[model samples]
Target: MQRPWVVATLFCLNAAAAGASPANLLPVAQKLPITPDNFCLGAQNVLKTAKQVLTDELAVLCTGNTATTLFKNLIAAPYAGTGTPALTQVFAPRADNNARTSEIMVAFAMRIPKTAVNTLLVEEKHAIVPYDSEAQPPPLGNQLANMKMSFQFMEPPKNEGDADTTFALQQTVDTRSVAVNFKDVSNHELRQYILHPDNFDFFMAGRTLVAPTEQFKKSVVVRGFMTDPADATKTLVVTVAHFLMNSRDQHEQLVLAFSNFLTTDVSKLYQEQIKP
Candidate 1:
C-alpha cells in the first residue's frame, strides 16, 4: 500500500516552520498515565483522563466452539449497521468539561461476503464532499469487490454554547480478504481480512485550554483474522496499534492503557457471540 501521508507530514512541517508564528506551534501538555491505582471504568475513562492522548499496540484472542458462525457474526456486525462492539461508548462524557471531551465513530461503505472478495483494490478517495456523486456510479459487483472503511473522531466543542461538532477523519482503512495457510501458528488454513490505514488526520479543537496543534500526527492500524483451531471451534485474533507520532513516556503509557481496555471489551464481545 502507498502511504502518501508520510510525505505529506514532512511537507507540512517544513511549510509551518517557514511561515507559521510561535503561537501556531504545538504546546507541551500534561500527560495522563494509566497506573494500577488510577485505572478506572472503561475505554472512555481512559480517553477522558487527558485532553491530549494516544493509544498503544493491543491484541486479543477470541475463542469459540463454532468457527463458521463466530466468524460470520463478527464480520457481519459493522456491515449490518449494528456497529462494532469494541468501539461502543462505555461511559458518558463529563458535562462540566465540554472542551475536553472526545468521541469515536466507525462507518462502513458497504457489506460483502468474504468469499466474494477477489482481486479487490480498496483505496481511500478523499474529497471535499462526504459521499461520491458521480453521474454514473460503479456497478454493484465492482463496488462490492472493493471496500473502504472510515474511522471518525470528533473533538470537543470550543465552548458550552456550541451545538454538535463535525467529526474529523481520524483514519481511512483499505480492506482486503486473503487466504493464509498456517504452518507454525496452527495446522488449519484460515481466511484473513486485513485492514490497513493509509492515512490519519486528527485535529485538536481550538477551544481546548491546552491545544496541542490544529492537527497532530497519528499512526493507527487494526487487523482481524480468523482460523479454525479444532474440528468445530474457531479462533479470532484482533490486533491494533494506535498512538501519537513522536510521543513517548507518559503519553505512551496513557494510550497503552486505553488500548488495553478496548481489547478486553472486544474479547468479551466475542465470547458473548458464541454463547448458547
Candidate 2:
C-alpha cells in the first residue's frame, strides 16, 4: 500500500506521459540510429503543421560519394571568401565537436553576379529559387552589405533528462541602397544529431523565426542531409516548408526574387573546387 502522496505522484506522471505529443518527447540525440530513413523523418518534423510559415526543398545527387564524407567536407570547407556572394568571415567560439555547445559567427556578402543568375534556371528543379534579370548592381541598389550572422549550437542537457539539441541563428541585413529596408531575422532550430555510416545527419523540428519588427513571426522546419549516392560521389537533400516570416511583405518578395541566383552562385563555387 503506497502513501497518499506517492499514489498521487504516480497518477500524475502516468497522465502526463499519456497526454504528451510525439514532438514534445523527442528521442535522445546520442541514442538515435544513423540511417537515411531516420534522418529524413527527423527532418520532416522540424516544422510541425501548427507553426509552419514558409518552406521549400531541394535534392542534389552526387555522381559517387558517401554521406559521411559529404558531412565532413561541408563543415571543413573554408568559411571566408568562398561560396556564392562569398563568405567573408567565419569564427567559432568552441571548435571541438565534443563540446556541449558552440557559437559561430559568419559574415558574407548577399549579392549575386548576373552570370550566376542565368545558369540557375537551367540547373535547378525546385522553383523556390527566385530570379530577377533587371536587378541593379551594388551601390545603385539591390546589394545587401555586411550580412553578419551568428549561430549557437547547444547540445542536450547532461543531467536534466532532456533529449534534444538546438541551433540558434541570428542575422541583420543592411542594403547598400536605402530604398530597401530588410529587417534582421532570428532562426531557432531544434534538431537531432545522428552519426551515419560515413556521414552525419541533422534532422530538425520546430524552427521558429522572429523578424526584426518582432510583431511578425514565422515558424519553419528544415531538413539537411548529405550522403554519397555511389562510390566516390556525394549528394545532399535540403527541404523547407513553403511559408516564410519577414519584417514586411516586400522584404519577403525581394528575397524570393533573388533566392535562385544566390543558391546557384554558392553551388557553383563549391563545384569549382571539386571538379577534377
Question: Which one is best on lDDT?
Answer: 2
Total backbone clashes of candidate 1, pairs 3 or more residues apart or in separate chains? 1
lDDT of 2 at 192: 30
Name the Cα RMSD for model 1: 21.5
TM-score of 2: 0.37
TM-score of 1: 0.23
Compared with the true structure, what per-residue lDDT tens digits does model 1 show for residues 53-126?
32222111122212233223444443322434344222221121223222221211112222111101111111
User: Which candidate has the top score in TM-score?
Assistant: 2
Candidate 1 achieves a global lDDT of 0.25
What tens digits encode model 2's per-residue C-alpha lDDT throughout 191-274? 332222112223233344544234223334333443322311233333232223332334433343334334443454334423
What is the lDDT for 199 in model 1?
A: 11
Off by over 4 Å in 2: 1-164, 176-178, 185-187, 195-207, 210-216, 219-221, 241-243, 246-253, 257-276
Q: Which stretches of candidate 1 lie over 4 Å from their true place?
A: 1-87, 90-101, 105-111, 114-120, 124-212, 215-276
